[model samples]
Target: MSVDHATMSGLLAGLRVVDLSRNLPGPFCTRMLADLGASIIKVEPPEGDPSRPLGPLFDALNHGKESRRIDFRQPTDLDQLREWLVDADIMVDSFRPGILQSMGLDFDRLKAINPKLVMVSITGYGQHGAWSQRAGHDLNFMAMSGALDQMRAPTGELAMSNVQWGDMAGGSSMACIAILAGIFDAQRRGTGRHIDISMAHGAHAHLVLPKATATLFAPVLGHPPGAGEDMLNGNLPCYNLYATADGRHLAVGAFEFKFWKAACAVFERPDWVERHWQRGQAPGSPENNALRDDVAALIATQPLAYWAERFEPADACVTPVLTMHEAQAHPLFADAARTQPWAAI
Candidate 1:
């Protein structure tokens, strides 16, 4: 679990970043940059970041970064912030579209101060749109992007995800990519770029595969799959979740013919090998539903441990569903301390 920070410390050794963001998205983005050896100066409000009260989360996001208190309401403090931006390689913020302009920190003014500064503006929506100035959080962005609709339970009830997909994936991750690309381009062209990242737009972009499948089969299926009706979701017996006798779950991801065949062999249901999607078994069809029911019934007869042991040597993609704590303790995550240095502290 030991990381050679000396080797990683020079990745972005000379980079200077001014982080004017609070809470999750902006802080997470800068945290990643800091991990890659960028010097991050976290510009907090006079009262500090709102997330500071969250304890561990704040520490996890702001570790290894310098902190500076700046009151934008004060002209002198704003001037000091501008001075810092003059030599900063990157600047990140999460204000609404016109908020920074009102505070005299707009991209145009900053560009004049430092033409080579890469400015990243992360928001719920883009810089210009009807919802650009709207107040929203992760759930609102996911709902707007149709991402939430796809996360539904077997009973057709919408399930809320524990992870902040919009904030972390759409906003933070996309902003990091945009920042790196902008830095590369600025280094080449000798001019910085203002990158506008919309969490909703980025979330929508992640649905490319599902969107394509829906479009490709909408004409034949009359409508897109709903809830547990999709092939990859829960329609096929070969690729689905089954409850064990102990009430635990097993994730069966035997999508391909080879894996499905191997899983069928493990279940002693060799006859079910050919009843697969690749062999013309239409997902969610009556035959597939019957096969899924049979498989589920069989799986329910055994405990999760039995299946886990059975599948340990099987080539099938079957795996026992472990709780978060169990996953953390698993050997797969044994080196987590190396990547999450703050966890060790």
Candidate 2:
């Protein structure tokens, strides 16, 4: 998915950006910007943006960007930052709510430097919420937002699968989109804007489903976090995972009658379809459990490749759970020779 430099000329050709954010969310936001040809000058303090030395993401995210090492507290450094801020089309940062104000880089002050600048400020709990000053990240955000209660590890402990699931996927991803939207609005209105992106709020956006369900049902029902008891929390058989004989897995997501019948047909067990298909209910019911057992037995007879071959061609949602290595080189992506211009990585 890499792009050649020449082919990326006019995407964001003349945009100048000053990035003051450190670590994951801000850098990831800027990385997407860099990918589109924005000239981003990442400003860091004397000690440096922590992510520059944060071992993992350097080579990948910071590839096409430049850095400006300056102590924004010092008079000269402030002068230089002001110069960049005054001229930049957009400025981004991930400081806490009032820390930017304390650091003399607040949006009001900086916007005064360049009224047309689109200022994006990202924070954990947002600027003026009850948990505004509270320290938080992905796991905490997920826990608070109800996105974490559904996933449990084999040990019965709450699973925190990937770090920054909420931070990057929720927070950083949302911030980048909001920033782009602000830029578009500025382009149309002829006046730049100040965007306050709350990482917690971004994380909270993922709670729409649970929140709506809880609200809709709260009058008649109860809250979630009931584990396998909750409706959409993998409590049913038709929408759950089954373990194979070799400890591999299969995702049986036959959430509808049509898909359920297709799955049963694919497994050559049509009787199980209507018997186990509780389309509107959750996973642990007798019908779903029986179907789960059937699928478990059927899929374990062969390896993942064997199952994929039969099911993939049929467009059955029944899929062999892929490992990390298998996913990158999977056949789904091995069609470079078939596309019009052919694929280029």
Candidate 3:
């Protein structure tokens, strides 16, 4: 049977999500749920969501969701919020541990009104931690979780990435997954569960690469080498970033042996094909460093456009580093860039 994906009933079509969280994480989670056809009601304070001033980001995250302004301190507004919660399937909040309870919106109280209500609390630490009440942002969480430690440059200096790994990937992404799990559990068990998402802990969970390679390097090794230390971290010539003649950058991620062989062939360095990671050459060794330098110099001989054209039809992993504007205009993301409002069920 043929099915139309756009016209089909969405996975979360019957779900109702009430977002009390502000800023990025909670709002982003609800936005994703809204995309999956869930009805999202974003309850804001009298002054509105703190992220409202962020312009494009606010519009992107809060679109297709209904907004209500309420003062939690006011009895009338609290009563109105209580009414809204009675029918909500999921509730997301980012307040500190006791803040919601202080506002008389505790899990137990809300469950008494509606037992199947899935409550998700997103925080910097967690519900039962000493740092639960501490205020922290994306960089703070990444720093606390050792994620920032792994982003060192070649000279052992820590590099700052513009992407919000902790806030968006760790916090928001985990919260989304947990909320869906909560929804499934509520539907099957007829009882909702409280989801506690700590942004720092979530970021820590994403430190998988370091943990996987822990045995390779001793803990006594004071500051572990970050860049150019491991195959995935830019040690190998075939899987690193290179600069073009025009000062533009190219990311060559030919990690597998076959792909690396293909890339070597494309670069007219057929002799380098045998120098794979498992070829008994230790990562970041003199030989590997020499190879990396050779690749960099070779790439720099040509402009970005030249390499882009050469690698376009080739199966080898090579791509030009693009700015945000360029990425948005790319044909691959053309469909995704047209952010439509959540379709009606």
Model 1 reaches what TM-score against the true structure?
A: 0.94
Q: What is the model-wide C-alpha lDDT for candidate 1? A: 0.91
Residue range 1-345, candidate 1, lDDT tens digits:
555655665688889999999999999999988988899999999999999999999999999999999898999999999999999999999999998999999989999999999999999989986889898899999999999999888778998999999999999999999999999999999999899999999899899867887876677678997778776777789889999999999999999999999999999998999999899988778998999999999999999999999999999999999999988787767764355433322
Regions of model 3 farther than 4 Å from truth: 1-9, 219-223, 336-345
Q: Pick the candidate with the highest lDDT.
A: 1
Residues 1-345 of candidate 3 have per-residue lDDT tens digits of 433446533767989988999999889989888877899999999999989998998998898799999998898999999999899999999999999899889998999999999999999999886798899999999999999888876666888999889988789999999998898889999999788999999999998877776557534344454665754777778788899999999999988888888788888888998887766656667897898899999999999999988888888888889989988787755665344433333
Each candidate: RMSD = 3.0, 4.0, 3.0
Off by over 4 Å in 2: 1-10, 153-156, 212-225, 230-232, 276-284, 331-345
Superposition-based RMSD of candidate 3 using all C-alpha atoms, in angstroms: 3.0
Q: All candidates' TM-scores? A: 0.94, 0.85, 0.93
- Candidate 3 — what's its lDDT? 0.85
The lDDT of each candidate is: 0.91, 0.73, 0.85
Q: What is the lDDT of residue 270 in candidate 3?
A: 84
TM-score of 3: 0.93
Per-residue lDDT of 93 in model 3? 96
Distance from true location, Cα of 287 in model 2, Å: 2.7
